[model samples]
Target: MGLFGKLFAGPQVDMAKSDANRKKMRELFNEVVENGQDYKLIFGFTEDIGWFNYGFVHGSKTKIGNLIVGWNDNSQTIVVVPTVPDLSGCGDATFYRRNEIRKAYQSKYPTDAFIIYPDRKGYIGINVCDWLEDEKLYVYVSQEEEVKEFTDFFLKRFQTK
Candidate 1:
């Protein structure tokens, strides 16, 4: 390859490493979901929406990381758990409830945001402007089947008609 080609070439990714990481994430997610039978478990990724130009321009969503959420109707609590691929292990879970959440909706842009349930604090991210008042959680699931399952289980229990 020429110098120009090397300079202009997009960032290269190690597919093998990415695949291994994905596999590890899946394994962790499965284990968490299996043990969380009492609560409705959903697998997905989270995003942080950034702001620029005094809120005039909304930057593209920045992927925070992947997670597996478990919510229990009886307890009226929701837990956001992380799925890390590294040897360091996963982080602690953040808990929320109906009172904390302001709104819940299925995002039209599935790739960006699938199911969003933003709480009173709204979207939490670095340099994020809370454009919407009282919005909370954000979840994005790529698979259609999993999305459907999550929607059915979550909305049915959490949201009121």
Candidate 2:
């Protein structure tokens, strides 16, 4: 765990919240994970404006909850999670890329271009972020073990099987 990770103690801090988010993430993950599913929003609210390539973009104000968005190239769809803390009150949480995320990770989860921060437990896990806006099929999973789980989930959602 990093300094902030130790300070935040993500694993102990919100295991319940994290577990709850994990369960929620799983549901959203499944939607995108399905082998036959087609174009659909996996999590947050979005329009069919078609911003990224032929794919659609999902941009919503994040909440305290965990959110994940991915493109299933085989299924030609998208998966999204809207995690906003104090939505109506505060501003939206920002994002960055993996390399970018790593920088922030080094800097302690700074919101930037297309990044995701796994709650706060060092390297125990990662907050999944769909980096479609900045780059195609580029996402960062804070949790390495969950990488494939996240990828497969997204593959099912945004790819054409």
The models' CA-based lDDT, in order, is 0.50, 0.35
Error of 1 at 72 (Å): 2.5
Query: Tell me, what's the RMSD of every candidate?
Result: 10.1, 15.6
The CA lDDT at 65 in model 2 is 38
Give the total clashing residue pairs for model 1. Answer: 7
Can you tell me which runs of candidate 2 are displaced by over 4 Å?
1-14, 26-66, 70-73, 86-142, 148-161
Q: Write the per-residue lDDT of candidate 1 for residues 4-86, one digit (tens) a residue.
A: 99989865545565445445544554455544556655545566556556567655655456465666767776667675424
User: Model 1: residues >4 Å from true position, as ranges?
Assistant: 1-37, 49-61, 85-88, 109-119, 124-146
Model 2 scores worst on lDDT over the 10 consecutive residues at 132-141
Summarize candidate 2's per-residue lDDT along 84-137 as a digit string, tens digits.
321212123232223222222211243312223433542212344322222122
State, as a TM-score between 0 and 1, how close model 1 is to the true structure: 0.48
Give the CA lDDT, 0 to 100, for residue 51 in model 2. 31
